[model samples]
Target: MKRISLCLLLTSFVITPFVQASNTESASLDHAQVTYVQATQSQNGSWCFNTQVHHNDQGWKHYADAWQVLDLQGNVLGERKLLHPHDNEQPFTRSLCNVQIKPDLQKVVIRAKCNDHGWGDKTVTVNLLSETGKGFKVTRNNK
Candidate 1:
């Protein structure tokens, strides 16, 4: 009975730290994801982008810090920087306006970045020509 009790206690001591470490690593892997985007073109030919991001923000230590609007060739056309962590807001929308986009370009990519993860793999593409795409909406105003 003494040997069994000692073995059980030893096993817990060995396993507890590993379990805690695994949980922490997995939590850090939760990258910020761009869930939606809305792009609008004004009469002056500049663009405006409203991007929505989803992240498991762990306060100021880890959160969705910024998002970017990029052309097809990965050139940054616009960026919106988040000043603070949105702990209570699971998914949030922010906008960047007066972004100059080339007339020949027909699409733009939206990507989200977290303070812990840098940039996420998930991205949303906005079609400026057809004004349609998955997870995105586009509008053009000539007036």
Candidate 2:
């Protein structure tokens, strides 16, 4: 019983992330060269960034989502989100998109919003997988 319980815990933390990563877009912050990245902490203990979305699928109906935060060395300071990622501003999503982050985080939340034609501003949250990035490319494509 002990072994079975341990296995379940490990599997939830280890194996589940891989499956989720496939559904959520992701990128590598580590690259041969440092890329466009920025990270700042909010007074409320959240992370804010202005970066490109990776694997951005193209098309009018096709929507893409990615949020990236790379350090000076192209390492992700924390988790990344991939599209119209956040909005601390008033004109934009109006605080609809935000992030809760911590140092050496055990987990992170990903949020996204969009104005597709008439429908938009959808928000969702997912736990951070055991993976992180350092640097990445800003090309537009869906994976």
Q: How far is candidate 2 from the true structure (C-alpha RMSD, Å)?
A: 14.8
lDDT of each: 0.87, 0.35
lDDT by residue (52-140, candidate 1, tens digit) is 99888888999999999999899998889999998898788999999999889988899999998798877898889867789998999
> How far out, in Å, is residue 22 in model 1?
18
Q: On a 0 to 1 TM-score scale, where does candidate 1 land against the true structure?
A: 0.78
Q: Can you tell me which runs of candidate 1 are displaced by over 4 Å? A: 1-29
Off by over 4 Å in 2: 1-37, 66-98, 103-133, 136-143
The TM-scores of all predictions, comma-separated, are 0.78, 0.27
Top TM-score model: 1
* Per-model root-mean-square deviation over C-alphas: 9.0, 14.8
lDDT of 2 by residue, 1-143 (tens): 99999999998999888988854432321111112223334556565544432222333343433333333333444443223422332222121224544445543222332233221222222223322344311111122
What lDDT score is found at residue 122 in candidate 1? Answer: 79
